[model samples]
Target chain A: MSFEPITGRYLTVSVEGAPRRIYVEEAGQGRPVLCLHTAGADTRQWRHLMNDAAVTASNRLIAFDMPWHGKSLPPEGFETQEYLLTTEAYIDTVLAVIDGMGLDKPVLAGCSMGGRIALQLAALHPEKFSGFIAIEASDFQPAWYDIDWFHRPDAHGGEMGAALVSANISPFAPEVERWNTLWMFMQSGPGVFRGDLSFYTKDDSLIARLGQIDTAQTPVHVIVGAYDLTCTPEDAERTARAIPGATLAVMDELGHFPMSEHPEGFRPFFLDALAKMPVATAQAA
Target chain B: MIETFTHIQSQLDASPHLLRLGRLFSETVLIEVDGDEYYLTFDKGRIVQVMQGPSRKTPWRFALRTDAAALSEFWQPRPAPGFHDVFGFVKIGRGRIDGDILCLVKNLRFFKEVLGLARSKQEQAA
Candidate 1:
């Protein structure tokens, strides 16, 4: 199906009593599907999703840049230096976007860091989302997963980003997609990636709270790339088994950034998940 | 400026992160800077030997060649685009990697992380 052109907007939202400007992009005209990006990445990851007929024609596809990411600048008086992403801050930003846009329990879909937060939001506030689609999301980061290499001053700018992109993405991914992903990685502001990794590899947690999710109210689906070394298919399966009624699917030959690495390549798996969503969930949204 | 063999050795030894990455491989790799060559002999991921001015007898499994300026730029605190990666350098004709594509592919991250130790040294000295 042909894709629709997406329109972008800058919304002013209040955070911690301070006004913050966030960039949100949208297409289509039905129920909203709030798309959250992976840490250090922006809404560009969801461009293909925003354009798809399955989403745009029948769903309100919305994606926003988190604070200090993409077009969303840091809040007033906030230091861009030593920037770090915190669970509370990230959740607050997503909440602000939802409230600012007046979205009602939109289908929350995210990859990696976005996936983890979607899971958290689903459990902590199941009523806030109609469905949770977690991609490359895991319950816990292995203890040995150390990001200290990024701490070195040298591990900034293009070099660090190159290392990260190489590690996260599979070598067999399409060359154009690989370069596109690398382009996005290079545009990241200094310390932004390292800061995001703080949450991805450190802070976020949902192991003890899986039971909080009421699947009847919020259906949770997970898809992990078989080639995703960071959050392997095994990790997704384990997490899926922990949450009652949660379903898991493994996307073959795909890596961590399935949606962005090759959006066309990732579409089938995503469409399959979309088809599995309960009919009532769409009606409810 | 030509980086002293001892300086590179010290830099690698000082970084715990680099050490962890290096420990993943046990191979002798040759690095040619300008016309000069140095052989880094690794024993189970540790830098066991640093032979200056080429190796006469040992057969290296992998070799990378680049000029001093490119190497220097790569070791900077924040390297620019072409200097940020080995393959990137090769792509731009500033560097080349040869011999054993398998070994290079298998331990690509290890090699990248370990070589990044040069920049960490500058960070430490600062």
Candidate 2:
């Protein structure tokens, strides 16, 4: 019988004084790499990375679905309250996961909203991480589309969400992978995508706090896709410039969801970015 | 313009699955290239009529406006980054969408796919 090398488990983590059963997945073994998914998405976005033998060869890749995402259910009494992911709450959840998993200085890698939080993590607690791979991230990204479209009753939230995101995937990406990425957005729970956007688009810009990120302690590598209009290469460039010694790479023939839209194409850029990180570089040495 | 839209209609009709995906979509949409206007009416997934207009009487739920040059570039087999998608066009200031955004977003996939038929036609012609 054929089987994949990945393993999945559930961990109880506290977010805002409430217990949340977070779904976590891991593969391979070595230097830990904590993967964070984009807004409205889950750990499934990292499936390709986790399954790849090359990436997993010397890295223990770990990914988890945020509360109210994927297999992770929201805390009890979720129906009564409107879900909103504030910066404080998001950071708390990540900290809980890192502590619960007992990861010592793991390389933090995230995409889009996940990437935005990576910057926050760097500024707030650079000592906790060895490096950061911020993909499709920027300090201040203005909301490009109406958030209401993702949840209004007049529209099919799933399809509308998927449709909006689908445009951001490169036309060159494999048809199957492109569809798979859209499928994830399509599966998002009602208001979940909207709630996530509350932080992504409406939250305070990191421009003011970016100077606090000490790259000497923890390296920051920003990667942006040329075709990602939402967080353009210019945005990433501006972000890199703000943080002293931070590096930026603009990947061609790619879009917003680089890793999910075309993993094979994204692997080289990802490896190159990872190689620049102190922890990964030391491991290679 | 009529011929081009006619070709789009035929191309859209050829794809059964695309029509099925739009089974719930039925609306009239306006398409403006440069200054010329065209009204496209859809009934449950099929484009039944394509009417060119300068007439103000034609009511449409939504409208997508762009220059002829921009629309042509958008129809290319592989357009540039900002010209790749409708939203991309809007984001980059190459296109403008107006009227009831709810109607446009509710049937977003269907509308996008329908408009994308022009690209397929362009590809075939090339």
Candidate 3:
């Protein structure tokens, strides 16, 4: 089936006790399915998913640009700031968006940093989401590598964004999709990418807390790309096994940013995972 | 032409990105550009030593060898085709990545950003 292009609007939400504008995009209608993007990326990552006729036919698909990302400007008085995305700030922003938009028991689906946050959302506020779909997420990701250079201010004019261009895409991905993925990287801010990794590799810890997540109350599904070196399939397997009744799927020929890097190739797996997620249990108070 | 050890060291010293990227990397990396070799030592996140010639006492985690031309192309403000990334060069056999594949993959972004600093220096020189 065919559908209209996804459209977006500015959302003014309270961040850090001050009102800040966020960009939220939407398509279709029914039970809301909130899509979150990877670190340093914007809502554009969900364009294909939002456009999928089957996805939007019965679900109101929505995505948003986090504060200081995409069309959403940095918070007030922080224009000149070198953004550092902390776990507290990231989770707070997501909660604010949900409350401000009045989304009732929406399903949460995210990849990478977003995937990590989806786990956090489900764990901390299980009553708020019906189910959680996490792609390329892991618990207790050790800081095995470094990215100090990417956040360096003096490194300006450097091709810091280019660093992510070819790093994660599967070598076998289609040429058009591969270049499109690179385009997204080239558009991200310099320090923002590094700042996002600060949390992805460091702060967002779920190992000790995974036990708190009850899959019976809020169903959870994990998807890992077979070619993802950063959040390997092994990592997702361990995470899935930790959470009771959490299902895991390993997608072949896909890498870190599966949602965007290979949307068409990724759609079937995403649909299958969605079909297996439990229905909404309850609504937020 | 790309600057030598001293200049690159100073660049790393000035970049917060480099400092963070090097934090967990406490190894000596041997970089060979067109057969000219350079050794970089990291402590914490600081580049402790950068010297010409080969490393003596320490075993390097990786030795990434590529010609001067490929390096130059990769550092262009907007590199086309084979110049966009190291993997691109590897695809065409213009670059060779040897040593720990795991280490290379994990820290790929850091290394790429480190190399990308060349564009800033080159632009400043222009």
Top model number, lDDT: 2
lDDT of 2 by residue, A170-198 (tens): 88788899989988888999899999988
Per-prediction share of native contacts kept:
0.03, 0.79, 0.09
In Å, residue A40's CA in model 3 sits off its true spot by: 1.0
| Candidate 1, A1-285: lDDT as tens digits | 954589999999987678889999999877677888886678898888887877677677899988888999887766635777777777888888899988877888888889988888888877767788999999877533234444455334434454555655654467787767767666877777778888877774688877677788788999998656568788899888888899999877677888888787789998877666654344665
The residue-by-residue lDDT of candidate 3 on A43-101, one tens digit each, is 88888888898988878889999877789888777767767887788888888999999
Model 2 scores a C-alpha lDDT of 0.88
How far in Å is the alpha carbon of A89 misplaced in model 2? 0.7
Q: Which of candidates 1 and 2 is the stronger one according to TM-score?
A: 2
Candidate that would win on DockQ: 2
Badly placed stretches (over 4 Å) of model 3 are A1-3, A154-158, A279-285, B1-62, B65-126
Name the better of 1 and 3 by DockQ: 3
Each candidate structure's TM-score, on Cα atoms with residue i matched to residue i, is 0.69, 0.97, 0.70
In the range B12-54, model 2's lDDT, one tens digit per residue, is: 8898987998787788899998889999988888999999988
| Over 4 Å off, model 1 | A1-4, A143-148, A278-282, B1-126
